[model samples]
Target: MKTFLFRSMIGIFFGAFLAVAITNCAVYFGGQELLDGETFLKNSLGSIFCGWFFTVSPLYFELKNLRLSQQTALHFMTVTILYFSLSFWIGWIPLHLKSILFFSGMFLTTYAIIWLSFYFYFKNIAKKLNQDLENI
Candidate 1:
């Protein structure tokens, strides 16, 4: 519980940092206007929750009974649902069908790239470990 709380705190801060950075970039490069106080607060809270979820979600992989594929699928689905819901609520994603579809594609592509990167990274580590063990 303590560890979980600690991670959650870290996640919240990290999320806030990301939200600020992204907002700054958008305002600077995209000519987007700064959000008003109430809207900004709402978006920030949503981002923090997203950060918390992303941070703690890896804990799901620790479940012994579930295969890695199952864990990945569950995590992906959970993230998708949470992100879409929050995105819509925060007005980051417009309610139009075309906007939804476009964002969904972008989200899935980004998720796949991240997932593959981690998958290969850990697989390389495991391979190295196995090779080291064989040399012992």
Candidate 2:
């Protein structure tokens, strides 16, 4: 319970940070402004939720520490495939049966974000787990 709470907290903050970073980059390079705060917030929320790998990896390792079952790995694979497929399809939906770039970029970016997110998430989890175990 405690570890999950900690993970959730970490995930929320990291998600927000990621959202803001991506949004800012988009605006800076794309030179497009949001029509309203609502739009910005919606987009940010989407960005944050998309980075669940941040919380998932640590939760997996945490489960390992607790000597939990291997279902975690199974869930990870399921969630991963689902995330990629959904993101890819939804991202290029507007392309409407045409446009390779749309699908390609969407697929690549989805995977890229997952990879980057997990890198930081797993790194932090490892550090904290060591600290936690040492104190135990």
Please tell me which predicted candidate would have the highest lDDT against the true structure.
Answer: 1
Query: Candidate 1, which ten residues in sequence have the lowest lDDT sum?
Result: 32-41
The residue-level lDDT of candidate 2 at 131 comes to 100
| CA lDDT, every model vs. true structure | 0.89, 0.64
Candidate 1's residue-wise lDDT over 12-122, tens digit each? 999999879877887899898766789778878888889989898877677889998999999898899988998998898999999999999999999999999999999
Q: Lowest summed lDDT over 10 consecutive residues: which window, candidate 2?
A: 63-72
Per residue, candidate 2 scores C-alpha lDDT tens digits across 8-96 of: 77777787898788778878988877546776776666556656555755455444444434644554575566555545544523545
The numbered model that scores best in TM-score is: 1
What number of clashing residue pairs does each candidate have, in the order they appear?
0, 0
Stretches > 4 Å off in candidate 1: 23-35
Position 43, candidate 1: lDDT: 79
